[model samples]
Target: MKLNSPSRIHMGLIDLNGELGRVDGGVGVALDYPNFQIEGKESSEIEIDFRIEIDEKDKENLESRIKNAAKNVLDIIGETGISLKVNDAILSHSGLGSGTQVSLSTGKITSLVYGIDLNAETLAKITGRGGTSGIGVAAFETGGFIVDGGHTFGEGKDKIDFRPSSASKDVKPSPVLFRHDFDWDIVLTIPKGEQVCGDREVDIFRKFCPVPTEDVQKICRLVLMKMMPAVIEKDFDSFGKVVNELQNLGFKRAEVGLQKESLKGLLSKLQEVSYSGISSFGPTIYSLGDKDTITEISNEFFDKFGIEGEIISTKANNSGYEIIK
Candidate 1:
């Protein structure tokens, strides 16, 4: 079986304050490009191959993720033997939901090889994903614009404190509150830099969380009253306004504050020309606007700053992943 999964932009985390009995609510969009495509077959032993060009460091990390996920699924199914060939790759830790996409794709492929059916959430649980944010998991299951209601908070609840997905293992994915078709042109900029993860990510969550309640309220209001309506109505301007405003609102503000000077400058440059913001713990900045204008602005910014990265002009993937048997 061959499977392809869409990559996603984690617009922002909402309600990190967790005063309202929930935490880590999220808003995001799924993209059509920078996806993962892999083919899996029943085999005598677990094996993984990458057909795409990638450096040794990235290849080793990618292989580890795939092997770990496959092993987890193999244990569950009481079966052996799955061979996976990665035909395409998503850059890891670039704020493109690459880890979740890679893990879920690996788990899904492994389960299918043994004829064990599972949804993304179940696969997520088995693979130890979707603990903090559901945006990535939701994007894999059903693409387009998505909002998740977040996990229950407090002692003995889904979580007791603020943490990133990698640290919040065993917690289930948050509930998706709203989903709608998003057909806007998007320009994705993946600037080369140190990506935040592991202890640093956990420290950020620990330090700034329970973000200001007012900011959380503002984000909720924007998502509910402005952003959702804008997407449903295809009001690019309204949606773009929310996108730009989110950068300074709540946890997003902190995320942006931690970016390197170069990345921060690039985001500022893009926002001047289009509605732009960082995606998750990013180096991947996304802008919503005329593809040509955003592309030109990004190129100019790169040229001026001598930054190295990739620019992808793509659209929302409303239909999610596809599988060919």
Candidate 2:
């Protein structure tokens, strides 16, 4: 059996730091690019192929990771009796929702092959893929501008609780086309290396965060007043400014090194020519603009920095993941 699943890039809007107990949630404007394809069986041997525009030596490592994910999925399905194969996943991970995308794509494939009728949300919860931000999984299942209320523990396993806050709780997961009109062209600058955010780091950062209730309230205000409005109005200037400001504020409050050296260098270069914002965690930076502006900035950055990156031009993907068979 063979299956193909599309990939998406998260154009971050608001950072949900104070609102969510775990990692800060960002309102994601999804893009259409990079798709995943799964081939072979669900029994003994599994093969994964990650298809991307860039060519590099990292394919070997990606293959290993994909195979492991597939194995895990099979175990979760309680079907180690069957073998599975996943192929042609994407390279963008750790920074953007790469892991989530891969996991969702794999889960979708497994469900299809096994005749299990699990929806994207269910699959996401079962696989523990979208623990922090459910938007990634929602985007994978259904693309567009998404605001995931975040996650909550459920009684036993059948019933899952989503979105503790009323604002996010009321907003269901679906495609936002007309209302949230965002012109989405993003420049993704990922520094070559690995930086993982473990539980200990999260714990330390949370412990050190300011206890004053008012301070946390202020951060939430910035997200609602500054970030949300910018995205809704499709105002790039306001959006970029707010993102930069919010990121700085979050980093300061957390007192953690949010931007690494390579990412900082890339940001400096982009700032000289264009407006850009850092994605969740560190390393992967995104610059928003139209097609021409994005292309120009991407070329300029490559010429100056000689960095391995991608210039993806796409609008808000109001249409979520579609199965092409």
Give each prediction's root-mean-square deviation over alpha carbons: 1.0, 6.2
**Candidate 1 lDDT over residue span 31-116, tens digit each:** 99989998999988988888999989889999998999998898888977799999998998899999999999999888887788
The residue pairs that clash in candidate 1, if any, are none
Give candidate 1 regions above 4 Å deviation. Answer: none
lDDT of 2 at 143: 67
Please identify model 2 stretches exceeding 4 Å from their true place: 1-23, 40-65, 75-78, 81-87, 92-94, 151-182, 197-215, 229-236, 251-257, 268-274, 290-306
Decoy 1 TM-score against native: 0.98
Compare the candidates by TM-score and give the number of the best one.
1
How do all models score by TM-score? 0.98, 0.70
